[model samples]
Each structure stands twice: as C-alpha cells, then as structure tokens.
Target: MILTELFREQLAYFKDINYAKEIEFLKGFEASEEEIKEFLEKISLQKD
Candidate 1:
C-alpha cells in the first residue's frame, strides 16, 4: 500500500473513535504542500 493509503487508514481509525486530540496531533504533522495534497486526495477516495 502507498504511504497516502497508510495515512488514510490512520485517519479513519481516529475519525471512528472520535479522537479529537489525535486529530490535532495529526494536524500538527508537518508535510510538504505536495504531500498534503496527495494525502487529502487519498483520504477523499477512501470516503467514497
């Protein structure tokens, strides 16, 4: 699986358990503009 997919899976787990602090922690994870864009795209695909 791709790195983006990995992050997507993690995002889902936190979202499922209502982990607000985890979400904040994740938000703090610094990524490049390209990485952020790619990660968001993967997350969007998972939502469908």
Candidate 2:
C-alpha cells in the first residue's frame, strides 16, 4: 500500500490544483494514464 499512500499524499499536496495539472505532475514521474486513473479511483474509494 505504500505506493497508494504516496499517491494519496501527493494528491493532497496538489488538491488545490487542476486535475489536468495533477496528471501532468504524475506523468513527470512516469506514471501511465491507466495508473493515474486507478490512483484516483482508489483515493475516491478511500473518501467514501
């Protein structure tokens, strides 16, 4: 779960920014589009 935790932490840090920017930032780390989608889904599930 460490990767998920890290993703969540980064997500929180960028919470105020646009979603597109978030995806760009993650892509800078070489994250694929599918990975970004999955990460967002996981974070949303955690919020529920």
Candidate 3:
C-alpha cells in the first residue's frame, strides 16, 4: 500500500490500544510497522 495510506492506518489505530510502550517491543519492521512503532514511541517518549 501507499505510504500515506499506511500512515493513515497507523493514525487511525491511535485509540485502540491503551499502552504505548508495548509497541516498541516489536522488531524487523519494514513499512507500516514503523508507523505503529514510532506512533507509540512518540506517545511513550512524550510522557517524559
């Protein structure tokens, strides 16, 4: 899928999970995985 659409998918997924730290535990990310990882990373990092 297009990167934009992938990002949108990530953004749309913003609310379903309650914990951001959990996303960072994933690895071997290629495309959409970063969107999710980074999104949650942003959330987790921002709390500091």
Candidate 3 local distance difference test against the native: 0.55
Tell me the tens digit of each residue's lDDT in model 3 across 4-39.
Answer: 555555554555767556444446654466576787
RMSD of each: 8.3, 7.9, 10.6
Return the TM-score for candidate 3, rounded to 2 decimals: 0.30
- Quote each prediction's TM-score: 0.35, 0.39, 0.30
- Clash pairs (backbone) in predicted model 1: none
Instruction: Choose the strongest candidate by lDDT.
Output: 2
Candidate 2 least-lDDT 10 residues: 19-28
lDDT of 2 at 20: 57
Whichever of 2 and 3 has more lDDT, that candidate is 2
The residue ranges of model 1 lying beyond 4 angstroms of the native Cα positions read 1-28
TM-score of 2: 0.39
Identify the leading candidate in terms of TM-score: 2
The CA lDDT at 17 in model 1 is 48
Stronger candidate by TM-score (1 vs 3) = 1
